[model samples]
Every structure is written in structure tokens, then in C-alpha cells.
Target: MGVMNELINRENVGMLAKILAEAAPGSHWPHVVAAASELDLLSLRARTDAVSRALLADLRLLPDPGYPTAARAFRSALTAAGFTGWILWPVSEAAVTLALEAGSGADPGKDFDDCLALLAELTPRLTGEFAVRRLLAADLERSLQAIQGWTVHPDEHVRRLASEGTRPYLPWAVRVPGIVLAPEATIPLLDALYRDPSDYVRRSAANHLNDVARHAPALVVATAQRWLSAPDSNTAPVVRHGLRTLIKNAHPGALALLGFVPASIAVNGPRLDRDSLALPGELAFDFEISNTGPADARLAVDYVVHYVKANGTRSAKVFKIGALTLAAGETRSVTKRHAFRQMTTRVHHAGVHALELQINGIRHGHTEFQVRV
Candidate 1:
């Protein structure tokens, strides 16, 4: 089986940027941008680095060739350039700062609306997050109103910003102090985009609400129930995704909702290695589940493989598997696939390893095993 190689060295990113730049100067930015995303997982921590920050600053100064599709390239470039502190620093703060400073307080009505309009136009291409931060830093009411106004815009992109801009722990974006301050106000914005026609916009709403749910479980649950109560085609999926974290790890209410029951799911069993069937090998596993429900569900499975490393350090790798659908009264059998496979660099040593089954992103059951090779 072919393994997906992890980005350890930045050979691809560095080389691709140069190649693209030489082949197509106008589109080189995107190449660099994609390279950055490709390398994001390899970084030791979840923040951008200093060199990446410098790149963003430079990219911001370069003039665009004025292409439309190339327009998104700007935001992607900004994201790529952050390199570090992308999520750590407040991005929206800087944008709103620029917006406010560019405005004249003397004319605050139509002029303010026009000013916001300009900001909205540039929003997809600019930064947002620290938007709440910037709002609090300057004029709170005005900033909130602007974001609220953005929620109703004809553009799906604007509506998306209304939610994404407010997400807590938004990656590479700064946290908004305002969200922590006037948390209730954030609800209206979430509500506006809750049933947005665009699935893209809806996902943003789900993520934002999920972030809020961490802090206000009751409020989030209430909002979720309000939507789930009716099972409106639109809101159901939104509610499910929004409540993912709560559902996962089996929060009491969520567990009850899912009708979870504890049973002796795990059974010690042995199997012959289809490959050799020569030496005595030990592997532990367990299971049984079928939706037999009304809807086609996307289930998430979680597992952590524990094995002794060649360096003698005990280690583990957690992974996801099998997002499939089973109709009502349907029988779907899921075959177990190893997340972390036999590696040339790592040897299997006798020790303990753990695995868990997650339904809809929630961990409903778990088991452990001893493997020796």
C-alpha cells in the first residue's frame, strides 16, 4: 500500500514557488499559497513563523494584475504569508483599524455606511477575526452594526464573513475580545447566517456556533434544539455539524439523544496474518454497528495506534476512518482498516495500544490491545 508522505522538509514548497514564479509570474502567488497549506501540517506548533509574517507583509504591498479569479489568490496569499501567529494574532483588528482611521468621525451616517460598503467589498480579500478585537479597540457599536449589516448582504461571501469573522479559535486569525465581552450580541449574527442558502456559508455558521458552544453550552444547545425541533432540511445538518464537539466525547444530553447504551462490545479474538501465517502474532480488536436510521449519515471513526518506536519511545498515532451512509433498516458492515500501518522505520513491540469508534465525530466506544512482532 502506498503511504501518504508527511511534509517533513520544505523541499516541495520552496521549489514550487520558484518554478511557478519563473513559469508564470502572475500566478506564482497561488503556487506559494498552496505550498504553504501543504506544509502547514508539518510545523511543530499551530502558529505561523516570523519569516512567514515577513512574506505576508511583502505580498500585501505587491499590486495584483487585476484578475478576478486571481482575486481569491490575495486572501490565500495572506493566509500563506502569515506562516506563524496566523491564528495567534488578531487579523480583523488590523483591517478595522485601517477602516476606522480612514473614516472621518464628523460624517457618521451615510458616510459610515459607504465606508462599511468599501470594507465589505474588500473583506474577502482582507482579514477579519480580530474584527471583534478591532471593534472593541475603536467604536464597538459601529463595528457590530457593520458586521450585522454584512450578514444581510446579497453576496454569500459577505454572509460567510458574518459568521467566520466571529468564530472563536479561528485558525491563523486573532481572537476577538468583543466576542468574549458582548457574547450575546454574537448570537444575532449566527442566527442570520444559520439557514443561509449556501452550504459554504452554512459550514461557516456551524463552525462559529461550535466555537461559541464551548463557552455557552446551554445557549448553543437551546439554539440547536430550536432548529432540531422542526428538522427543517436546512437547519438539521447545520445543527448536527454545529453540535459535533458536544456530540463527540458523549456529552450527557447528546448521549441521550443518540440512544447510546453500554455493552460488552469488545471480544478478545485472534486472526492469522494473511501475509505469512507463520509466526505467532498478537493483535487486539472489537465492534458491531449499523445505522438502521432514517437519514444517510456521515460517521467518523477514531483510533490511536500504540507501538514501540525504534528509538525505544512509546508512541501513538490517532486517525479517522469510514464516513459512509446506511439507510433506515439498512445493514452496513465496516471493515477495520489500520490507520498507522507497518513502517520500515518503526517496529512493533509488545505493549498496550488503544482504539475508539466515533459516531458523527463523537467517541462512543473504545478498546485496547497488545501487539507483538
Candidate 2:
């Protein structure tokens, strides 16, 4: 389709008719132009399935030292195509430059890490493993060098790309674990990004750490606590976000850090036996609290579940009940409904999966039951 595929600049989109008038048979201009309108004229990635695959093929054609319009077009194409698009990664570092130019947040598809893959080819990470591993570790070193130097470029977009670009899992690009399983490996890069001054860059640093936390809780917790303790204005948000999961999970340390406690618990209905009772389908709970102090109190009660995920990893999650005011000697009942339809899916292979009730985010009551799916 000649280069009609590459007219992706917001300014050039105005010239779409002239470009589309010359589309060869099977050309992707009409679709790319049409889709580009739906996505911000300068949107980050391909939006629809057909458009993604079409752009995927077109993106492979351009080499590095990309033309602006072509580079932008290639970004959408690769972004939409996702992991499948990055099959061309080793051969073209050009896409990385284009991605760097875009400087947006995460890509849209399941294969977002494809460009990150190119960085792996450019650097040596101790844990360079990724969803679809095809590159040699040696090739990644050179690419990493180029990426580091590009950090100093004047374009905020490009600078954002430097940090947002390296996430092990950039969601939609590709799912990799350069930093998730191995935090130490990504530390140097994170240090560079933490003080970046750009909220965009700082946010990226935060998200990357948050992603790492899901798989490696301890690393994220430690990192978050360290950041909270250190006196750096830029890192606070990143650290707070990183610790959010842990806080929700009722991590002992996190509860202690925030000085959170289960002040009062009021449960309605039958008190559950922790050893032999399992919530089936729909279960209900009611809570009431009495403010024992002189001043008004703000509080919350969470329903904590020891979930056995489809993959069998047991974890806890908290759902908020909002803030409440309880003047002294005032007790108000809070109603809650705990749905157990999903628990049926966790038909365990034995052992106990605990369900807990918390007041002000701390565990106060619990019930357990057997499930075999």
C-alpha cells in the first residue's frame, strides 16, 4: 500500500482524503484513517481488531530513524497488533523510537510489552524472562545502552517513553517480568526515573512498582515502606500506590504503618464457625459501631476473603464500607452482603480457606467452610 499506511500525524490526518485517494488495492489507509478518528487523532495504539492486525503488518515495513508520520502510524499498528506485532522487534529498533516519541501511558492491547521486548534486547536484566521470549540476552544489551542515553532528550514525550517504556508488563504491549520477579535488576532504572520531576514519568514509576507488587508482595511492601519513610516529594504517590494492594489485603505491616485498627464490629445474622461453615451462594452480614471516644470517629469495615484463585494462589482482598461518624454512645448498624457464587469456583483440594470480617480494616471475626468443585 505504498506509504498511505503511514500518514498518522494529527496534522496529517487532515490530509487523509488526498492520501486515501491513492490507496492501492488491499491498502490499509481507509481503515487506519477511520479508526484514528475514533482513537484521539493522535491516539497511542490501534483501537479495533481489524485495525490492529492491519497496522501490525504496516509497522514492520519501516526501519529506525522513522519519519514522523510513518512513525506515528507504526505506533498504532504495533500497539494494536500487540505481542504479535513485536515479532519484528529484533530486526527494527525503529518502533522503540516511535514509542518513545508517543510518550503516552500503557498501550491498549494484550501485547503491549512488545516494544519493551526490544529494550530487553538492548539491556541485560538478571530476570529478563517475558511472555513470549525470542530474543537473545546479548542483543538486548546494546538496545539498553541506546535507551539510557535517550533519557536526556528534551522531549517530555521521549523522556516519558524512557520510563513508561521499560515496564516489564506494559499491559497490551506484552507481559514480561524484567522487574516483577527481579526488582534489583530494575532498581537502577527506577532510581533514574524516581526523581524525573515529570508527573508523567513519576506516575509511570509508580505503576511499574504496583505491577511488580501483585506478583512479588514483599518487594513492593518493602519498597513502599522505604519510600514512605524517605523524604522525597516525588516518590510519595508512587509509593502510596505501590502499597495500596497490601493495605487492602490487611498486611500486618501496612496496617501498622497507617495506624489502622478494627475499633468496633457489629455483625448481624448467625455467627459463623471458623472451622465448618462456608458461605454458599449469597451470604449476608450487618455491622454496627459505638464510638467510645469523646470526638467523632471515622471508620470502615471490610469483608476479607482468603481467595483461592483459579490458578490456586490464595490471597486476601478488602472491599470498603466507607467512612462513618459515631458520636459517643451512638451505635449504628451497617448492612453488608457477601456474595459467594465465585467461591464455588474455588473448590479446594482440601485445607482451609478462611473468610474474615473486619472493623476499621482489621480482622475481627471469621468463618470457614469446605468446597469441592
Candidate 3:
């Protein structure tokens, strides 16, 4: 994974320098490249942010005295490297972000304008989703106004960024408390694009609503119901995705909105292949399920393994097995394998662990197993 990111290393920096040297021969390309190459890329936690920050620091070393000068030099290099279209997405993203990071300490009004210009030039190919958040954090009203304008932009990417950038639960970015405290701030933006013709834009709007759903479940459910109620709606996919977390957690209102109410279920023979197991072993289990209802049933089957933590307490981790549609008198058998191997994300402790069968988020049957380290 890290090897693929070699595009952000010394070699790529040299390539970018060569382009800048051509675009503006007077700029100190050699000095900039050397300074940037010396940055401790291995020390930075994330690849994109690290490479961007390195470029920003190196641009600062240029003889240019102000943010405008540095930004112009970098933008010139970007144009020289054929960054206008979606030719090199990752490269364009890193370079454009360098422009934003370069102006972090400059005047707020100027920096905001610069970021908007850069996003217009490079977005869709290289998302300004993460970069726009800085402005949101700095000037709430001004940034919100700018993003509202973006919702109707002709560019699909810019329109998507309008919703994506404001997402309260956007991964790899800090949470926006403003959206959490007053989700109404995002309603207009989401509403504007709910029926957007572009899938890209609609997906972001749905995801933004989903994030709000975590903090305001009732609001999201109501919004989804309203959208679903529209005479002609294109929001089904979006609403389904937005309600995913809620559906998995079996929120009553959410399930009712999605028409996925729990059904009566029974589990049989849910026993491990072996009651005892050692480290680096595979634990296998099989089960039988039957729907003894008068009508067909829709079931979301899952398993919960109560892993014994280091402190001797057990923590339950739910793993999805399968979903089933069973007739009134239908029966089915299900089998699954759980690997008990070493993993970076989990540590196994020796103990008897409790495992249960969950049908539509309701616990049905329990089994026990012993694991030795």
C-alpha cells in the first residue's frame, strides 16, 4: 500500500520541479525540490497529508515573500503538468492541497477566495472536500454561504463537494460540531440536491443526511419518509444507504420506515466444530433456522461472538452472516468460519467465549467455546 504512494516521493517531486522550471524558469526549482525531498515523509502519519504538507513547506522556502506568490508558482507548475483535466487525480489533489496548506497562515478572506478558486480548477478530479472544511471551521457564515452557492454549481464535483464537505461524519476529517448542533444548517443544501440528476451529487447529499441521522434519528427518518412519499422520487437509493446504520441497529422507526420489522426465528445446531481451540486455528460453526410464521419472512441473520478481553471482560462483536427470505414453513441451514488468527486490530485472550445467533438484531440462541493461546 505504501509503495503505491511512491508518486509522492523524491522522484515525483523532481518531476514537478522540472515542470515548474519550464513554466517559470525564473523560479528557484532546484532549491525547492531539494528542500522538499529532505522532508521526513516516513514520519507523517497519512500519505496524502504528509506529501501535501511537505510541498507546502518547500514552497514557503522559495524567495516568494507572500502566499500569492507561492500559490502562483505552484499553480503554474500544475498547469505545466497537465493538471487542468482529470489526467492525474492523486497528483493534482496533493498539489492543489499544497496550495491550501501554503496559505493556512495568511489572511482569512484571501485564503478562502484562493481555496475556492483552486477547488473550481481542480475539483471532481481532485476533491477539495477535505480542504473546504478549514474554511468552515474558520468562518462559519461565510463558508456556509459559499458552499450554498456551490450546491447549484454546474460542475457535479463542486456540487458534491458542497454536501460532502459539510458532512458531520466524513471519514478522515474532523467532525463539524456546527452541523451536529444545528443540522437545520444543512437541510437547505441537502434539499436542493435531493433530486439532483447526478448520482455523484445525490450520493453525497444522502451521506450527509445519514451523518445527521446519527445525531438526529427522527429528523433523518422523517426526511427519508418525505422523500419516499414524493410523487416522483429519485431518492430511494440514497435513502436506503442513509438508513443503513439505522437499519442494522434495528431502530424501530427506521425499520418501520424501511418495512423491515423483526420476525419470529429459531436457531438449531449452532455449535462450533470443536468446543476447544488453540491460537492460529479456525473455528467453524453451522446452524439451522426455521420460520414458523403464517407469512413469508425477511430476515437479516448475524452472529455475535463475545470475545474475552485482556481484562477478563467479554466484548460482543457482531458479524453479519447472511440475509434470507423464507416461506411460511421453510427451513434453511447456514455455516460460517471464524478465523482465530493474529490480527493487528484484535488480540485474543484465553477463555471460554459466548457466541449467539441474531436474527434481525434479536438474540436467539447461545453457544460456548474455549480458546487457548
**For this target, which candidate reaches the highest lDDT against the unseen true structure?**
3
- In angstroms, how far off is 188's CA in candidate 2? 3.2
**The candidate that achieves the highest TM-score relative to the unseen native structure:** 3
* lDDT (Cα, tens digit) per residue for candidate 1, span 44-108: 22222422332344344447421222224323344443322223121223233344544445664
2 against 3, candidate with superior lDDT: 3
- Candidate 3 least-lDDT 10 residues: 83-92
List residue ranges in candidate 3 displaced over 4 A.
Answer: 4-7, 29-31, 39-64, 82-110, 192-207, 231-234, 279-281
Ranking by lDDT: 3, 1, 2
- Provide the lowest-lDDT 10-residue window in model 1: 270-279
Clashes of each: 13, 19, 0
TM-score of 3: 0.79
Q: Pick the winner on lDDT between candidates 1 and 2.
A: 1
Which scores greater on TM-score, model 1 or model 2?
Answer: 1
Q: Please identify model 2 stretches exceeding 4 Å from their true place.
A: 1-156, 194-198, 232-235, 261-286, 289-301, 305-317, 321-356, 359-361, 365-373
**Per-model C-alpha lDDT, please?**
0.52, 0.49, 0.71
